[model samples]
Target: MTPLAIPAHERHGIRVFAAALSPEEMQRDKAGLVAALFGDPDLDPAHVELFDTADLAGVGLAGYLAEGLGVSDAALAPDRARLEAVRGPVLILHSRALHGRAVTLIPDPRLTLLAGYTEERPPVHFEPLPSDAAKGSLTAPGPSAPAPRLPRRALALGAALLLAGLAALVLAWR
Candidate 1:
């Protein structure tokens, strides 16, 4: 098993690894997943190193994929014991359809599972707080300022415009 390494310089920030039971979930919503994890656009990318479990197997982490789960092409399985060798916390983004099964498949105490996907902007502040023991005095990256929200007046104006457009359509239909 090729150990997942975080260079000495990168150790100060949280180490993030992404595993998926379904490859399509990661393939389709990777950016959204990252955004969901680190909502602050200004958060340094180096603070979190995102790696796909599928790609890990290519790099010689054998048996990285789950086996005997009766599912085809399942993502890295903590059941294999190789995951224990990982240095930090792992975040598993799995299909909503397998929410129940994911619980049973991944039993590593270090792994966190997030089920479901949405194309719309995801809720922010999704990262789990790392324990001091796990991080070893390393300073976790601070979250940047939240995205500025539209003022009430701007929102009201947009709503009014939408309502007017709808009313016009209704009148034209008559």
Candidate 2:
């Protein structure tokens, strides 16, 4: 399904038209026609609005639209009245069904299926940590205080001897 990002004013108008379309009448071009009537610039064969009235328990339909369109739910809230005007390819999600309701008039033939909601993953780097700071911090634990004046060769030999002693101890313990 194509995802349409409608602006606030437009979404309200579309919602009104969609609510009236129902499930039977809104098939294919019909949906496009309704959208076009509502002045939808992107209302073409490829781009169309899918009226989702699914399991909106935690988040309401407006919220879902907001999340889907990447906008605030308040923007879509005022358009409910307009949304109730159109009957088109509408999918009532979840176990809830709209029956005989005035807003639920017109069977949208385009309303074929009502799929479950799928949460969208935000952008991969939408909230990336400050890279410069992260990189600086990663390398910030500086050279470990210069090892208190131990010579490089002496340190190496000491490490080797320590390792040998540890190996011997392990062997002895075993």
In order, what lDDT does every prediction score?
0.39, 0.42
Q: Candidate 2's residue-wise lDDT over 99-160, tens digit each?
A: 11212223334433322222333557556566776553343555655556878999999999
Best candidate (score: lDDT): 2
What lDDT is reached at residue 66 by model 2? 61
Q: Give the poorly placed runs of model 1, Cα more than 4 Å off.
A: 1-11, 17-21, 38-41, 45-47, 58-174
Candidate 2 wrongly placed segments (more than 4 Å): 1-17, 29-42, 52-58, 73-174
